[model samples]
Target: MEQIFGGGIIWTIFIGFIAGLLARALKPGNDKLSFLWTIVLGVGGALLAWFVGSTLGWYKPGEPAGFIASVVGAIVLLAIYAAMRKKK
Candidate 1:
């Protein structure tokens, strides 16, 4: 199986956090997530990228996207979250 930044979940979380932060910085408007939530956003974004990328043949099984793709995934997720919250 392909690996990203090596084995285990720690590296995945680390990359996800960084990707999430970058995504927040790259996206416009305000985000009210706390530190923990931010981390969740990042990790979730990375996972999303992995799933979607793999489905689209953009990534191999067990292989996650790089920084850019991760950030893009985070941005999309953030936007969706924001929109859903706004409607509530």
Candidate 2:
């Protein structure tokens, strides 16, 4: 079981969108993202979650999270993105 690429890329992106939307909605804050950015964030976050989940084996193929997990994962990805951008 791997959180990073559970199920595959297609599934990852599909679930990533759902996760990202929930993540943003649940933890909406400052900083506005265009449509593209949100998708990127979502997809990236899902990939990140997959990798991270793989480390802990928290995510399994064909099964990610209900909601909370996705939010947490996306939040982490967003935070990491912000931090990296801040550095650049």
Candidate 3:
């Protein structure tokens, strides 16, 4: 089952949670993201990492990034979100 999904959906969700938490912690200013948004942020981050990492030959498709990469991805997204919000 795990092989079917590579690392499985559960692993993605768990990594997303951890990445999101780390992102929130690292980001400056008070947190404004909701619970759902937090999850989205994390998952989005993971997706971003996968995309970038794969493009850079850091990882293969269906391969999940390590915790540090996930967190870094999350932080980048968070920064983008903040910038967009600031412009509004």
Over the stretch 29-79, how does candidate 3's per-residue lDDT look in tens digits? 777887778877888877777778888998876676667776788899989
Q: After superposition, how far is residue 64 of candidate 2 from its true place, in Å?
A: 6.0
> Across residues 23-49, which tens digit of lDDT does each residue of candidate 2 receive?
677664664677667766776776565
lDDT by residue (tens digit), candidate 1, 1-88: 1254334677766776787888889889898777777778877776677778888899876665666776888899999998999998
Model 3: weakest 10-residue lDDT segment is: 1-10
> Per-model C-alpha lDDT, please?
0.76, 0.65, 0.76
- What's the ranking of the predictions by TM-score, best on top? 1, 3, 2
- Which residues of candidate 1, in runs, are more than 4 Å off? 1-7
**How high is each candidate's TM-score?**
0.84, 0.60, 0.83
Supply candidate 3's per-residue lDDT for 54: 84
Clashes per candidate, residues 3 or more apart or on different chains? 0, 3, 0
Quality of model 1 by C-alpha lDDT: 0.76
Residue pair clashes in candidate 1: none
Comparing 1 and 2 by lDDT, which wins?
1
TM-score of 2: 0.60
